[model samples]
Target chain A: MDRKGILLVVSGFSGAGKGTLMKELVSRYDNYALSISATTRSPREGEVDGREYFFRTKEEFEQMIADEALIEHACYVGNYYGTPRAYVEEQLALGRDVILEIEIQGALQIKKRFPDTLLLFVSTPDAETLKNRLIGRGTESLDVVEKRLSRASEEAEGIENYDYFIINDDLDTCVTQVHQIIQGEHSRVSRNLELINTIKKDISKFQKG
Target chain B: MDRKGILLVVSGFSGAGKGTLMKELVSRYDNYALSISATTRSPREGEVDGREYFFRTKEEFEQMIADEALIEHACYVGNYYGTPRAYVEEQLALGRDVILEIEIQGALQIKKRFPDTLLLFVSTPDAETLKNRLIGRGTESLDVVEKRLSRASEEAEGIENYDYFIINDDLDTCVTQVHQIIQGEHSRVSRNLELINTIKKDISKFQKG
Candidate 1:
């Protein structure tokens, strides 16, 4: 059966290690494409337009919104950031699961618009471990670490809305779990409607004989 | 965080090879327990209680129904068959996923009673392939094969109601896919409420400090 790829929306706390997990997952797996967001913010030095982000003007970004070209968009600190629909659709058409690393609000928005999208929320095993990750790995001050912890706390409230909640304790295990989840989701009845319909029709025809 | 195992209800067309797939899955994985059904039918020679089935009298079966001891039940050819709740509950509490191989009617009943149960419907790649396997392996006459095909056609209508639709083309692939799906389901938010709630509470407490 030829199955289309899924839209995988991943969100997590700051210290959940989702970034590393995603990097390893994409690097090891051949069937995933990382989504590139379109933004109105100016690109920093050494940042490529298509690589880091698809940079656009405020007018262009709003135009995309009007044209329904963006899957989900948000205005943060006066700049617009959104996921472009074309790239995701292209990757999915080629049978590659498109991975979108977004926040809870964007994740929910995409899921609402595209019901087939799989929303995953990642978190550390406990808060103490998360705190240590934030403090131990950073050169930032205590205030910054506390701010990140507060953001994580806010994010924790929305974990219930996600389809899957992953505990990312080990990098290799988390990667395998996430990959297998995506693989398993491909077999969902809703996702494999074409294949199922064909088999249903064939069986119905055979019954008449 | 510790979590309870899920109730996995599997159904399929007659020639889908689900029985072989499940046997290999349980043999390869140690965390699964195949569920034993209770029946009012007289035990055939060599069939022991609690092994092939939990044999019971007509009165005992009706009493179990009144007591709500059976998860799902149906009468076929004047004999009653049902799944016992106590054994399933015990296995789940022990963190072992219980596999219940049943028909579409019983599968839907269990899903209705316990919404957390995962319902999977298996089929062959196509009707012709299923017919070939049925005729190739069985000693039954063409009339019986035709009856099985007819039944399969009726069962196909209920495939859309299942959470997943598996194509049983290769035995090893089917077993691995089923195992991964069950493994991935353990990460679902609905199944891991205790773990999620603890994480939420711990993060909230951390934010306060």
Candidate 2:
């Protein structure tokens, strides 16, 4: 059976290794497609349109919003960022599990819009590990690290709303767990109604015979 | 973290290979424990108490029912059969995923009692395959096979209520899929509340510091 793909909305706190986990998963598995966002912000150096982001003008982005062509959209720092509905649909039609890495608000919006969307919140084993990982990056001041932790704490409040809470202590294990979740979701009774109907039809033949 | 095991209720048609699937699952994995049912039926030759079943007299079984010990109980053919609550609880506390293979009615009852129970319904790919398998068994007469098939058709109506619909065309693949479903369920947010709370507490430390 050619099972349809699921929309996987992945949200995580800063320094939770969600980015690394996604990278490894895509590299290891050919069944996943990382969803690219559309933005009004100008592309940075070495960035390509549709590769990094689908760069669009402010007017075009607004048109998309009016047309409802984006699954979820948000304006940040005078630029609009949104997940393109067309690209996601195309990937899904091809049976590739589409991964959308977004914040809690956008994740919740996607879930409300598409109830079947699998919402997963990735986190470290504990707050101490999360704090240390942020500090270990050494790319920011202790003040910045503390601010990230505060933001993470705020995000933690919404983790309960997610379908799954993934502890990313081990990257390999976390990736496998995520893969398994998407795989098992395909077997959901709701998703396999067509298969069930086929079986039901086949069973009726015996009654006639 | 020592995660508490979940209650897995498996139900399927007679020729769906659920028995073979369960046997393979137990042989390949060490984390699962098949729940033993208590029954008042006389033990057949070589049937040892607590091995094949927890043999009990009608009075003893009634006493258990009065004590509110059975998760679910039903009378069939002048005998009482039930899932003992004590053994299931003991296995769960030890972090073992307890497997309960029962009929649709009993499976639904267990789900109603334990809201956290994961219910899975297994089936063949098509009704033709199911019919052929029953005939291939060669143990049952054609009349008995028709009755079993009729029962399966009736049972199919309740499958939509199950969490997953596992197609058991390939025994090995079906076993692996079942294992993955259980493993992925462990990551569900409702099941990991204690871990989430621990993280919340650890996060509070950062705020104080």
Candidate 3:
């Protein structure tokens, strides 16, 4: 069956290696498309429209809100950022799985609007590992690392809401697990309604001589 | 993280090759245990207790019902049969995935009683293929074959309720797909609560100091 694409929402604590995992997944697999959020903030030099983001004026972003075109939108640092529903629907129709990497609030909002969306939570197996990844790999100060760790504690409360968990202990294995999960989602009964309906019709028409 | 086993309910139309697929799976994999149903029917010459079935008296079966020890039970041809909850729970706690090969009604009953059960429906890709297999492989009368086909039509109505469809286009591929799906189910957030909770607790304990 040619199944529809999955709306996958991936959330993770900072320094959990989600960036590396997603990079490997997209580099190795051609079927996934990363989502670009519509933001009211201006794009920096060399950032292309629709590729980096759908840059919108504050007024235009609020208008999208009024028109109910965004899947889930949130404000950060006095700027509006949201997922564009049309782009997501268009990619899904083309049979490309849309990947949305967002924080917990936006992820929950997307789940409320689209109940079948598969939510995945990624994290290092322990907070100690997360802390090492943040400080050991970066030039960030102790204060910044502590701030991110605090935010991680808050995010942990919502991990139960996701449908799957990807612990980034090994990059290749984590990527493989995520890919297998999304692949398996295609076979889910709720997602394969078209195939199921066709088979049911065929069974109904079958007659014995 | 190690996780508990899945209650896998498998059903299919007659001559769908589910029996062959299951045989191949069990022979090739050691992680799965086929469920042994408790039945009031008299055992055949070679059938043994606790292997083929847990032979029980009709009175004992009724007692089990009263004790709420059976997950699901049904009567056929004046004989009572049921899945013993104790056996299933024991095997699952040992981390062995239990397989239940049953018809639509029993499958649905198991799903209702165990909401986390993974329901799988298998079939040949076409009704004509199923018809050919039933006739070519057996000496059953046309009447019997027709009866099975009629039953299949009725069963098709409930196929949509299953979690996945295993199209038996190729035996090895079908077995591999089933294994992959069951393996993938191990990563589901609903199944790994212990790991999720442990991570959540660890994050909470990580202090900003």
Candidate 4:
């Protein structure tokens, strides 16, 4: 059977190495595609449209929402960001597992719409390591870091709702675990009910004959 | 975190290679352990107790059930058969995945009690091959083969309820797919929520400092 692709929703706190893990997953797996989100924010240096984010005008982004073209969208710092349904569907139909690295809110929205979607929440091994990593970044100010930490705690409370969790203690292990989760979900019996029904019919014909 | 092992319920028609797949799984993965079923049926020649089946008397089986020792049990043709709860629990507590090979009815019963258990239904790619294999065995009469085929068809109808459907077209491929399913299920977020919670707390603490 030509099985359809899987929709993977990944959420994690800042400095949890989510980006690194996603890079490793896509690099290692052949049939995985990372979703490109549309955003109203200006692109950073060296970031390409349709690769990093589908840079959109504020009007265009609002229109997308009105048209329901976005699967899940959110407003951040006066800028809109969202996952486009068109690209995700195209990739899924092509049998490529689509990965969506979104926040807990976006993940919840997607899950509500697509209950079958796999939700993975990644985090550090412990609080000490998380604090160390945030400080190590050297980019965020102490105040900003504290705010992020508080937000992270709130996000952590939502972990119970996720389907799987990956510890960012070791990048390789986390990637491996993530890969296994994807593979396992693909084999979930609920997804293959059609094939099973077909086999039953075929077997019945043989029995009668 | 040392997560608990998975409770795997594998069921299929005869000649679907369930036994072979289980053997290969346990041999290849140290984390997996096959649950030895206890049966009141007399052992065949060369069958070893605790390996092939935990041979027990009818009274002994009844006593075990009265004591709530079995995970799942049933009476078949005046013979009692069941899975021992203690052994399965011990192995699972040790973080070893335990697989139980039973019929669809028994599997459903187990699923009712343990909704988290992964149920796998195996079948051949097509009917003709199944027939050929049945006849190839040369141990059963043509009538008996037809009976088995009919029963297999009925069993196949229940495949929809299972968590996975594996086509036993090739031994190696089927075994590998089953292995992948096991690995994937372990990655399920539902099973790792505790670990994720711990990680989230850690990250929050790190970010605060």
Q: Which model scores highest in lDDT? A: 1
TM-score of chain A of each: 0.83, 0.83, 0.82, 0.89
- The models' CA-based lDDT, in order, is 0.87, 0.85, 0.83, 0.83
Overall local distance difference test of candidate 3: 0.83
- Tell me the tens digit of each residue's lDDT in model 2 across A123-208: 89888789889999877678878777877877888988999888998888889999888888888888888888887677765552
Candidate 3 lDDT over A31-71, as tens digits, reads: 89888888987766767888768899999999999999989
Q: Could you give the CAPRI-style class of model 1?
A: medium
Top-DockQ candidate index: 1
Q: Give Cα distance to truth, residue A61, candidate 3, Å.
A: 8.0
**Model 4, CA-based lDDT:** 0.83
The sequence of per-residue lDDT tens digits that candidate 1 reaches over residues B8-85 is 999998778987888789899899999988889787676789877899999999999999998898864457889988
C-alpha TM-score for every candidate? 0.86, 0.87, 0.81, 0.89
> What does the lDDT read for residue B169 in candidate 4?
80
User: Could you say which candidate leads in TM-score?
Assistant: 4
Residue A138's lDDT within candidate 4 is 74
Give lDDT tens digits, candidate 3, residues B141-208.
Answer: 68877777877878888887899887888999888778877877888888888888898898997644
For each of the candidates, the C-alpha root-mean-square deviation to the true structure, in angstroms, is 3.6, 3.6, 4.5, 3.0
Residue ranges of candidate 4 with Cα displaced over 4 Å: A42-49, A56-60, A66-68, A206-209, B40-48, B55-68, B76-79, B196-209
**Clash pairs detected, candidate 2:** none
- How would you class the docking of model 4? medium
- Give the residue spans of candidate 3 off by over 4 A: A36-71, A75-87, A206-209, B27-30, B36-87, B206-209
User: Candidate 2 chain B — worst ten consecutive residues by lDDT sum?
Assistant: B200-209
- Give the better candidate number (1 or 3) by DockQ: 1
DockQ of 3: 0.43
